[model samples]
Target chain A: MEHGTTEPGTAGPENQAVPDRPTPTPAPGTPAPGAPSSGAPAPVAPATGAAEEEHRPSPREQERERFRRSRRRRDTWIAALSTLAFLGLLAAAAVASPGWDRVHGLFLDAGEFRAALPEILQGFWLNVRMFLVAEALILVLGLAVALVRVTRAPGLQPLRLAATVYVDVFRGVPTLLLVFLVGFGLPALRLQGTPSQPWVLGVIALVLSYTAYVAEVLRAGLESVHPAQRNAARALGLSGSQTLRHVVLPQAVRNVLPPLLNDFIALQKDTALVAVLGPLEALRVAQIKADYDFNYTPYLGAALLFIAVTVPLTRVADRLQRRAAQRTRAEAAR
Target chain B: MNEPLLRIRGLHKRYGSRTVLRSVDLDVAEHEVVCLIGGSGSGKSTLLRCVDLLDVVDDGTVHLGGTELTDPRLDADVARRRIGVVFQAYNLFPHLSVLDNITLAPRIVHGVPRRQAEETARGLLARLGLADKERDHPDRLSGGQQQRAAIARALATEPELLLLDEITSALDPELVGEVLDVVADLKQRGMTILMATHEMGFARQVADRVCFLEDGVIREEGTAEQVLTDPRHPSTRRFLSRVLDRR
Candidate 1:
C-alpha cells in the first residue's frame, strides 16, 4: 500500500557493461522496476531517483497521507460491522422462529451433547486410525500408478495397462459404493485372507477409491513438468530412471502438494462413511446415541469433530496454494 | 591433420512427416569452438540435440573420439556422459539450489563423492561468476545468472564435448552479454564446444568456425569472419542480413 522504494541495485552489471551506450530503453512494453509491483494504492511517482529521498512533503501531500490513513480505518470498521450484523441477524431469526423451543431442546441440548461426547470421542479414534492407514497406502499406491502411467519404457506396457484399468474402475465407481462393495461384498464371497474387520475393509475400500483420484492428481503433476527438464537431465548424462527420480518427480511433487493435500482432506472426512459397516466410528456412535435418546445433538458433536481436523488442513492447503502463486508471479516478473 | 573430438557423418533427423535435419555433417576439433547459425526452424537446435545424443538421429553416425555414439546398440546414457549440453531455456532444475543442480549428475549419475561433487560444483560456480548465488534456487536468480549456473552444471561432469543450443536466446538483451561472456571464457579454457546461436556478433567474436544451416541442410561453413561477413552461399548472405539488420 506504499509508493515504490525497493529497487536498490539501480546500476546493475547490465548498465555497467554497456558503458558506451545509454541503457537501451527497455523494449516497448517492459515495465520499469520502479513500477508498482501490485495493485495497492500508489499516490506518488516511482521513487527511483534520489530527489524523492530529500524532498519534504508539501501541504497537499500531508493532507493526502492523512486522508489515506483515515480511509483505511474506515474501511476496516465497515468490514467488521457488516460481518457482525449479518451473523447477528441470522441468530436473531433462528431464535425468533416458532419451533425454536422444540428444535433447541432436540438438537442443541447441552446435556445430550455431554452424554454423547465420551462415546463419540472414543469411536472417533477409529475413524482417525482408518484414514491414517488409508492415506499412507493411497499416497504410495497413487505415486506408483502415476509412475506407471508416465513411464515410456517398453517393458512396462502390460503393467501400465493394468494400472490404467485399476484407476478407471476405481475412479468410475463412487467411494461409498466402493466401500459397500469391499465391506459387504468382499465378506460375502467368504474368500481366504479377506479382512474380517470392518475398519480394515473400510481402509482398503478408502485406499482403492482415493488412490484413483490421487493418481490422477499426481499424473497431472508429472505431465505438467516441461519436457525440456527431462531433456536437460538426460543431456547431463542421467539415465531415464535417475532423471525421473531426481529431477522430474521432485518438481512434480512440489507442484502438486496443494492438490494432494486437498485429496487428503477429503479422505479424512470420508473415513466416517465406514459407519455403514458394523464398525462404530464417530458417526455411528452418534447415530446410536440419537436413536436411543430421540435427540439429534450427538450428530452435531460428530460434525464438529470432523470440522475441527479438516479446517486446519484446509487452511494449510490454502497457504500452500498462495505460496505457489506468489512464487510463479515473482518468477514471471523476473 | 588430427582426428576431431566430435564427428558427425550424414546426420539425418525427422519428426514424423517433417524432416528437421537432412544430411548434416559437422565436426568440432579438439579445443575448437564451432557455432551453428540460422533463422528459426533452420534445424540448428536439432543438430545440437542430435550431436549430444538427446535426440536419436534417423540416419548416419556420431563419433566421440573412437566411440560410435549413434550405433544402434550404444547405451545413450553412457555416450551422454562424455558430452555436456546447455539448452536455450537454461533448464536449471527449479527445485534445486544452484550448487545441487550442478552437482546432481556428478554425485548421482557419475558416482562422485558428495564432498568432492560439491567442491567441484562450487569451483564451477565461482568460475562462472555465480559463487554467491550457489545456495539460491533457479527462480531466485535472473535469467543470465540461471544460464550461468546451467553452464556450470554442464561442465561439472568434465565432458569432452560441450553442446550449447542458443544458450542466450531466452535472455533479456542486456543480460545476453553476461551469458556470451561465459561462453567466450569457456572457449578460452580450450573446451571443445559446438554451439547454435542467434547472436551473429557474439558468434563472430567467439566461434572459431561457423556453420550456416537452412532448410535442414548446411548451406555454408567456414571461419566466423569468412562465413558471417563474406558468405559464398546466397542463402547464407540473406539469412545474415535479416539477422544482423535488427541489432
Candidate 2:
C-alpha cells in the first residue's frame, strides 16, 4: 500500500502505466527475446536471428493469425449486440408488464421527472456541500487519530487511549443513529455553544463515524510499511514525528488511497441521510415531491443523482486497487 | 589517535529470550576503517544496530564523540545526527527522488535550508557518479546505483562516523564492486567507518583492522593481514576458507 497504490491519471499518466515492468506484449505465437514473459515459455531463439532461415512467418502460422483476428472481431460484435439486445428486451418486458401504464405514470413520468429535476438538483447541492465539508474534516481528524494510535510515546499515552476509545465507540454506533443523536441530543441539552443547524449536526455525525474507519485504514497502511524502513529513518536522526511525516505517512496514505476513496464514496451517499435531520437535501426533496403528486419519479431522479457521483468514485477505487496490484506484481522486475 | 570517534563497551542485545549480541566491545578511531567479518547470525548487524542506537540495548554503553548514546537519559536522535548508516539492502525512501532521498534528513532534521540541502545532495550524488539521477526514484535505479544513492543519502549530513551493515550482501556479483569502490573512496577522504562484510577480499584490501564475530561475540580482532592471513582462531580460519572456496 505504500506508494504501491496508484492514483492513476493523476500523476504523469505514462509513468503510472507500468511503474514496474513494462510488460512486453506477447509476440505473435513465438517466444520473443527480452520480453521476459512471466509465464516462462521456452526460450526459443528468435526466428530472425539466423539469416539463412526465412524471416517470413509460415503459411500455417499466417492462417492461424488471420483466424484469430477474425474470431476476436466477431466476438466483439457478438458481445456488444447481444448485450444491447438483452438490455432492450428486459426493458421491453418491463414496459409490457400488466400494470405498465400505472407503473409508468407513477415512476417513469417524464413530465414529473422534468418538474422534480430542478428541486432535486438544488437539494443535491446541499448533499454535495455536506459531504465535502465532512470529508475534509474526516481526512485531517482521522490522520491525527491514526498517528496517535501508532505512536508509543509515553506522553501520548492518554491521547492514544482516548483515540482508541473514540474509534471503538463511534465506529460501533450506526451512522444514522449517531446522526440522530447529534441532531437531537445536543439540542435537547440546549447547550449555548451547540450547533443549531441540522446540516452542521449531520456533518459532525458523519465526521465522527467516518473518522474512526479512516483512522483504522490509515493505521493499517502505516503498519504495512516494513520495520526496516522505520529503522532507516530513525537511524538518520529523524524524530518519531518527523520520521512519520517524511517517511511513513506518505507511504501509508498512498497505500490506503483505494480504501480511503471507498470510504469517501460511502460518505457521499450517506450525506442524503441528513434529510432526516430536516435539511432540504435530495432525499427529502424526492420524498416531498413523491408525497405531493403521488408519483415516485423524483425518487428515481434522486437515485440517479447519487449514482452519478458514486459510479465514478467506485470506478476510481477499482482502478486504484488494480494499479496497486500491478505495481507490486511488477516489483521484482523493478 | 586523538580520540576514537565511536566507542562501544559491553554492548548486549537480545530479542526476547534469544540474545543476539553478547558483551560486544569495539571502537573506530578518526579516519579508520574497521570491518566486522563473520557468517550469518554472528551478530555483526546487531552490533552495528546497537552502535547506531537503532536497537534498545539490553546492556551496554556506546559513546559517539563523548556523548553516551546508550544512556537512557540521552537523546538518541541527537546522537544519531553524528552517525550515518547504510543498510544491507538499499532502503532509500521509494516515494522520494534520489535527490530528495539524499536531502530529506539534511533538510528535515538538520534544518538545513532546502536549497542548501539540494546543493549538498547534488554534490554527493555527482561525486558518487549519479549526477543525472537526481530526478529518478530509488526503484528506477539498478541495485548498484540504488546502493550508491543510499550511501550518498547517509553521507548527506556529513556524519562523523558511518556504519555499513553488509551493504553489498544484497547486490548481484557484478554490482558488488561498484558499491565497494564507493566505500573505498569514502575512506580515502578520511571518513571513519565501521562495516560488516562477507567480502574478505575487499576487507583485506582496505580494513585498518578486522574483527571476526562468532556466536554473538567478537572472537578475533587485529590488523587485516594478521587476522585474515595469520588466523589465531580455528573458527575464523574455517569461515575464511569456506568464503574463499566459494570464490
Question: Highest lDDT among the candidates is held by which one?
Answer: 2
CA shift of B53, model 2, Å: 0.2
DockQ of each: 0.57, 0.54
Model 1 lDDT at residue A70? 69
**Chain B TM-scores of the candidates:** 0.98, 0.98
Return the lDDT, model 2, position A323: 76
Native interface contacts retained, candidate 1: 0.70
- lDDT by residue (A1-334, candidate 1, tens digit) is 1112223232254222222211223334433444335444544533454434434444444554565566668778999999999999999999999999999999998999999999999999999999889999999999999999998789999999999999999999999999999999998999888888999999999999999999999999999899989999999989888999999999898989999999999999999999998699999999999999999999999999999999999999999998877766665555
DockQ of 2: 0.54
DockQ of 1: 0.57
Per-candidate Cα lDDT values, in order, are 0.87, 0.87
> Candidate 1: where are CA atoms >4 Å away?
A1-63, A331-334
Indicate which candidate wins on DockQ: 1
Candidate 1: residue A319 Cα off by (Å): 1.2
Tens digits of lDDT, candidate 2, A1-334: 1223333221231232322322233435544333343344433335342333433554444444566677678778999999999999999999899999999889999999999999999999999999999999999999999989998889999999999999999999999999999999978998889989999999999999999999999999999887888899998999988998899989888888899999999999999888899889999999999999999999999999999999999999999998777766645444
